[model samples]
Target: MTIQNSHNTLPLDPAQPERQARDEGQGPMPPQAPTPTQPLAQPTPQAQVVPQPIAYQPQPAAAPSNGVALTAMILGIVGAVAGFWAVVPITGYFSAAFGFPLAVAAVICGHIGRARSKRVGGVGRIQALVGFLLGYVSIAVMVIASAAWTVFLFIGSL
Candidate 1:
């Protein structure tokens, strides 16, 4: 087979029969006539795809992490426990020393946690408040114990 370009005279490969037919100004080849030996297969009509409107599904809001509140609560508990030990005489000094920092930390964490809870939602608000109260109570206990110890020491020394 040979193909002649309208612009120039050039022979095209027989392998590209579609290109040759197109160059010759002919459209795609028609379906072949089925032989008697091979029955003609009817073209099955395809189902037309109708796009349905997607239903709007609102996803549930994820819970925010309240680790700060949790930390505050834990620190408050531990600090309160240490402060309780401040009831003792000499040992109370060491207990107060150990617990004061913990109490302070608990108070700070509680305030931070409470603010965050208010800002983000009321998830850990209770815990934060509890921690704040516990920390103050612990500090009070330590202060009272230290004063008592100081007076007792001063009187004994005189």
Candidate 2:
């Protein structure tokens, strides 16, 4: 019927006298005797602990969009074109300067790309093969040009 001034208990409606008001840290107190002046004995209240929720985080993406074989293909094409020019009469030195290293890199990248593609079930087998072929052709051209230059020098010295 009235608010408990001392215990900070919840307010009660006079219509529901049977309902008991629970304290912040105390459990239900036994009902008081018919005499309103007497106090009832109360049991010790148990403290309930609520567990906190853990935070969720997401990881970064792993796979690349375009294939490595595509890169090998382009490098092989450029290197082969450069090395082909080195086989010419006057452009050997100039082309070799850039072509030799590029051709070697192309060959290495092509093989690595092919192996990686195979492992990942990639659809760049043909591209890798073409790139590997171009790299081999470039290296062969460079070798031939070098051998011919050496032979010409040997013959001219005589």
Worst 10 residues of 2 by lDDT: 14-23
Task: Give candidates' CA RMSD values in order.
Answer: 11.5, 15.5
* Residue 125 lDDT, candidate 1, scale 0-100: 95
Candidate 2, residues 109-152, lDDT tens digits: the string is 77888788777667677777777788889889988887787688
TM-score of candidate 1 versus the correct structure, residues matched by position = 0.61
Candidate 1: list runs displaced more than 4 Å: 1-61
As a whole number from 0 to 100, the lDDT of residue 132 in candidate 1 is 83
RMSD of 2: 15.5
lDDT value, residue 154 of candidate 1:
98
Q: How many Å off is the CA of 137 in candidate 1?
A: 0.6
Question: What clash pairs does model 1 have?
Answer: none
Give the clash count for each candidate. 0, 0
